[model samples]
Target: MNTFRLSKRIMNINRTEIADLIYNKIIENRSAIKTQFLKTNETVGYFFMDDLLPTELALEIHAKFPTTEEAVKRKNIREFKFTAFQMNNYNSLLEEVIYAFQDERIIQLISEICNLEAVYGDENLYAGGLSLMGKDNFLNPHLDNSHDKDRKRWRVLNLLYYVTPNWTLENGGNLEIWPEGLKKKQTTIESKFNRLVVMTTHQKSWHSVSKVLKDDVRCCVSNYYFSDTPFLNSDTFHITTFRGRSSEKIKDIFLRIDNGLRSNMRRLFKKGVRENPHQYKK
Candidate 1:
């Protein structure tokens, strides 16, 4: 149980402002946005501090959060996850804030940021919750699968709202983006507190959570929005693959094998013969 002071920080753009920004950004620079994404060979784009929340309140939410090893092991990657835990809609303030996030304005903003057409949004908020990773916790590079419940729609964007006050690069738990493959070094994205990162999630968007090294927990609010169509015209099917960084050869081989097996099974039994229990149902 960690005890910390609570605080708040409001942003210049609230719900109304966010919607207007999205619409205007889309209408103004559609061609430039599309061209940038195509040339980068990356599925997503990022926007930061677009909307701000009360810092003290967010810290209080973090203070009250339960720290559980079992939960982290179940949801986190091993050999890393020294301290990682999460709670979903655990309080009214968080729920209210999350609910406000479902507005069309916010959704459109995300779509336009990624230069994609607005398709659909997930207000039900399944798997879209709070996640905390402390010293040593890490997520390996992987591709987010392409669909939502029952393969109904394509999951195009991953919105991460980080809120760890005074967090720094040396604290670890940075996000590594592998625009190229594992053979090439990755581009590291600092998970700055109060900063929101909206990235494209598709076959080529290989990313992972770096290992944390500080005593404080790096907290983040995770959300995913889906659309009726895919982000790429030449997108191919694949599983959520994982890979070790350039150094860990053995781990990389094992993970690749694991991904291959799961992918093969999915292809043989379209829609994955068994129901995926990770879905959020309302």
Candidate 2:
């Protein structure tokens, strides 16, 4: 198994310290954060950090991780499935950092920043663990699956921790946010090392990961928080649809047809008649 070491200093900050940083940042820029996501300014807001993950821990996790199967489905003719490598069931130091994310301090800070009350998962650790993505893999633009285990609440926030050392823009594997609708254009978010991208996910939040250009894996930690209420003012049901970039014509058509079928199935069978195992449970 691949293995590496955790940093000696940064790892000692503890959960309380981390939470405080998140809280202070939110209070300091509450209005700006809210406007960034809600107003006409922009559909997405981003926050970056150079040391969110202790370098040693990040390196170690990256070394010891295993590659996951690329889950693929036909979205359209040229458009294919959201294929990528993922290892959610974490071992090594990976689990420690991921679970620490749910600390009450951090959650409260995130809730305040987004101007929403923080409600967490009770049945189990709805929070996710570590994940790794390799070359040629891609995640298509789609709405996140709403609700946690048992459909008890609405899943509102997505906290992503990217930890690939020396990951450069030229490498490609970037996070693409399609806030203004795919037909218009897309805003690409760089998956920089130690960067934490916390995004608002509701019925309208449409996002995806671009295809990786190199053979090196792009590793990340993925987490989600659930609330008793939905984030959107209007509660609507939309399937997790996928589409090709503006240029892929025939592929786009096929994906639209594929999305329609899945969407229709969900209408008839509340949960789409299939269990989505992508989520985290206790």
Candidate 3:
């Protein structure tokens, strides 16, 4: 059921109202979130907040989210999921909410809370926008690509807003952050409804999505914020590296070799053998 649809007038404005909601929520919770990030800053700093929007709005967004058939299926031993970045092809409300997070005020506020500088939003929605995972879908532990599409800026942070109502830890498709590496125990952050999780992205941040254990399809809105320099001084450029879980001993080794080969390829080719087709073409 289409629970709600933005009226013509609501879609024409700057979406300041939703942006204000995001800004206010983050402002009210800024201190605690800052402390939380600090607590884990030595490794992979991250913090999450629930009820990020009005409950009814979140549910309405979920209802309008595109089905798996309407998305781009990305499946392989490394990962299995559906992603959509061409925001114009979907509900306009989704695009509005997405760019709302990009609002100048919200970006500045996030910078203040996360102690970051020179941050900017991606209007192209590079490797972001929407994600959906269903039964058996999973993303192996990996570090995001270090830089933006053109290698002009460092990809510093990832924002994920989930809207699936009644989602639970048991349903899987949760964010797993491996602060230490694949050998160490990782942290699982549930992808609950109306929750927004912000995580620092750079070297030592190996994270993934657990396989969906149930038939439910998990939907998420994602964005990445880039900066003029690395969030961590020690960080360097690399491809989107992936590794199998520790249990998959052989797959892990294969992935390691693959990562190395791909890293070398990037050094030689600069832009890779081909362009990544994950960004908004327009």
Candidate 4:
């Protein structure tokens, strides 16, 4: 498929149309949305929306997602999932839809709803873009990295758009937000189709994904917004921190040690030993 034609057909100012749809939805429900975020932000700082986009459009985006073999696999204790940000490696439609969220209007509306200032979309897709979890894949509770790819701006918000049609709670692959800490019961957010979840990422905002129980895959388009200021006034810099569930005591100890070692390395080497190959080059 010609990249240009594919993008044109799928995106077709569809990027603008999607943004417009989101903007209008926000406008229509500004009071309710703001109230929801305000209440949740007091505890964990998060919000979610259902039927975020036209179901058919989201389904088309999901249909264009590359297979797990085409994405970078992270099969470590911290996580087991497939992610792809090298836009050229996938269909141009994927690239168009991903960048569409970066549109300024969408960014402004999101910032306003979240009561944030100076929020900026990441064009580089640092740790953003597309994510897939198949059977047994899971992400341990963790705090996102404190900054952008260059470590210049503070990572403040995480935007995840789930598009796997007919996904259910029993299917697993749901997002778990640890508002009070891992020892307490965490809030489980179902990864339903056409749902968009936005959460604040700070020093204490811990979150993870449940293991996929079924053979089917859970697909999502992700994006992060950064700002010049931290989400919390007391927020300090740190690497992406991970923690084991409450039941996994030994795993928790080991993960703490691992996080300590990585944090120390980042302290000595701002950019770490090597660059993270998770960004779009072009």
Model 3 compared with the native: what TM-score? Answer: 0.94
| Cα displacement (Å) at residue 241, model 2 | 1.8
lDDT of 4 by residue, 1-282 (tens): 233554556555456666766677667777877787999897688888888766667788899999999999999989999999999888877887788788898899889888899999998999999999999999999999999999999999999999999999999999999999888999999999998898999999999999999999999999999999999999999999999998889999999999999999998999988998888898
lDDT: worst 10-residue window of model 4: 1-10
The 10-residue segment of model 1 with minimum total lDDT is 1-10
Where does candidate 3 stray beyond 4 Å? 1-14
How well does candidate 1 match the true structure in TM-score terms? 0.77
What lDDT score goes with residue 60 in model 1?
Answer: 51
Query: Model 1 lDDT vs. the true structure?
Result: 0.63
Tens digits of per-residue lDDT, candidate 1, 1-282, equal 011322122222244433343346454555655565556544245444422444554555455454544334434332354222122524434444444456677676556656679567766454465577877678887888777755677887887777777888899898877777667778777888666666787777888888888987787767788887777776766667787777778888888788888889999987787875443344
For all candidates in order, the CA lDDT equals 0.63, 0.64, 0.90, 0.89
Report the error of model 3 at residue 160, Å.
0.6
lDDT of 3 by residue, 1-282 (tens): 122533333444345777977888898888888898899988999999988877767776788799999999999778999998898899888888889999999988888778899999998888899999999999999999999999999999999999999999999999999988889999999999999999999988999999899999999999999999999999989899999997899998999999999999998999989999899887
Clashing residue pairs in candidate 4 are 11-14
